[model samples]
Target: MERSLAALLVCVFGVTTGEFVLAGILPAVAGDLEVSIPAAGLLVTAYALGMIVGGPLLTAITAGRPRKPLVVGLLAVAVAGNLLSAVAPGYGVLFAARVVTALVTSTFFANAIVIATSAAPAGKQASTVAKLVFGMNLAMILGAPLGTWIGEAFGWRATFGAITACCAVGLLLVARLVPGDQPVTRSRAFGEFTVFRNQDLVLAIAITAVANIGLLMVFTYLAPLLTGPGAFAAAAVAPMLLVYGVGATIGNLIGGRLADRALLPSQLGALAVLVVLLVALWASPHPVVTGLLVFAAGAVGFSVIPGMQTRVLTTAAAAPTLAIAVNASAYQVAAAFAGWLGGRVIAGPGMTSIYLAAALATVLGIGLSAVALRRDRVRVKQSVLR
Candidate 1:
């Protein structure tokens, strides 16, 4: 909609690309650095850990400054991080570089939510946040595939180099298009957590975490799932991911619109669909069927994201930015947890177990969403009577 919002979206796209491009190139990185695959996986783990720590910390530290400059500065950090990764001589250097990138990633991700909501028209705030989130999904859909292609064709370093260039473009757009606005000076760090005292907000965040656990559980192991015995050929992975990306793009737009129209019902339906889809993915025997189910899983899982975000915004009206930022951090925490859990399952039982666990988590998320809806209705009735 707004030029400023578009600029922020560009920044989000670049940040997301920089953050996740490593997934597609991990094998190359492992080979190049002479590390095991599990160890190379630490690059993703390290970034998530950084985000878990950095999101709230940076949100609080920058609470007193202007948002535009802070966002621009964070993008600069992302650019530098990617550049460092491109030139890393060893696994340790790459890991450190990922952490640095995540620090900026956390700050930028949280602040973008703040800026989007602030810039939107009164009733469209949640929709604005969803549009920014669309950039994130698109990055996964587009960035990872493209990065993998580049990595395969050139080298993993080239993928990182390309991301560095994208970050540069994002920085230039932020500088040119984003309006100069002072940050919300009244918002404090822990003040946002007060929303947790509201049962609906707490439930909403929990639902978000649960939903993500399901999504990331499968996603974290997608490559291996596709390449393992009875799985799709290596040549099919990129094409299947392209299908998944399309589903993700559609899901993001649908989620935003549904949330804008009817938040609770949309969320409930999405969670239910996600649970069913995950179960179906676990049950599918054929590789093509599994690939299609993966696409369905992406569609349904992402379709809930905007609704969950809007639910938090509505429940925590007092500190929307802090709540949203904290929620972003929560998602990363969920991702890290999901990755760990999925890894454990893969090591113990198999990849199928990850989807089974995800399905169970999605069911739990549905129950949480129901509780949140009931709590919100109770609050509304009380306010009306008052």
Candidate 2:
């Protein structure tokens, strides 16, 4: 890995840990803050709203700044935000702090991807992005668990302290390693928005948002699905989620390599397989089968992400940072929508119906990918005639 990429990896790991660690600590947060667990859960919602609304807007606002300093500044703010969370006086204070911290998450991520990809060797951008994505994987696999352990051992506030300390280390690494003279495109804020007018770019962004809904939806409800229909004990939830996370990490790396070789084809295959896995999950065939499929579903589901990000970056190279930030926002939008839709499904049909709904939702992603693939062929043929 490039030195800069490694540094950004640390940054990604830290910021994402902050985002994800709340799940394990929410009950603790509620008890301390004198709020209901569900109310405390709104902190997650606050962060998503921050990422969704803040990412593109903040990236565009900082578009004129030097890349190196921008990332450093963002991470510094994140460190402070986490510290604030650690010492927040009440739920309201903690909520605002989370939003503030989240405001920088997507912008930092967008800049980090651009920095890493810009330094990548030819034809290796997607894989490079995948490497950066390992930070998120590590956040899920290692950081969240460790943070949860710390919270349990100390307090929920201590979890924030640990995350803050990690962000500070990431901040130092980023400043030392990332080049001082990293280039910026320096486009006007409003002008960057014009990239959205490009139909292909819009489609790439939409594909990312649409394709991820089912995966996030199911993941959000994995505990209930596993316990209720899969007939697994509550004790099984943690280990099963661990298996899913491991599969996701492996899939992300493979997907990166596949995307580097053949972007759309790999994405199409992954999505198709994911659709099948979701349908199979709906069957609730057996505990063993369900467990295996959980892992496979995670692998296939996340395998599409690097390609999705690559497609967005490819389509909007002139405004890659803004485009990717918007892409992240779109993903958060999908997550929010997926949660809402999943709730409706749970309320109406049943818990098991989530998988069926998920599979059907993924079919839309397949259609979009197929259409994008066909257009690529048409564009190539036309260029040949010309």
Cα-based lDDT at residue 46, candidate 1: 86
Report lDDT (CA) for all predictions. Answer: 0.80, 0.93
TM-scores, all models, native as reference? 0.90, 0.99
Query: Taking the tens digit of each residue's C-alpha lDDT, what string does model 1 give over 206-260?
Result: 7777767877887777777778743788888777777877887778787888888
lDDT of 2 by residue, 1-386 (tens): 38888899998999999999999999999999999999999999999999999998998888768998989999999999999999999999999999999999999999999899888899999999899998999999899999999999999999999999999999999988888877788777767888888889999988988889999999999999999999999999999999999999999999999999999999999999999999999986799999999999988888888889999999997788999999999999999999999999999998999999999889999999998999899999999999
RMSD of model 1, in Å?
2.5
**Prediction 1 TM-score vs. true:** 0.90
> Which stretches of model 1 miss by more than 4 angstroms?
187-196, 223-231, 285-291, 344-353
Over the full model, what C-alpha lDDT does candidate 2 score relative to the true structure? 0.93
Show pairs that collide, candidate 1.
none
Give per-residue lDDT, candidate 2, residue 28.
95
Clashes of each: 0, 0
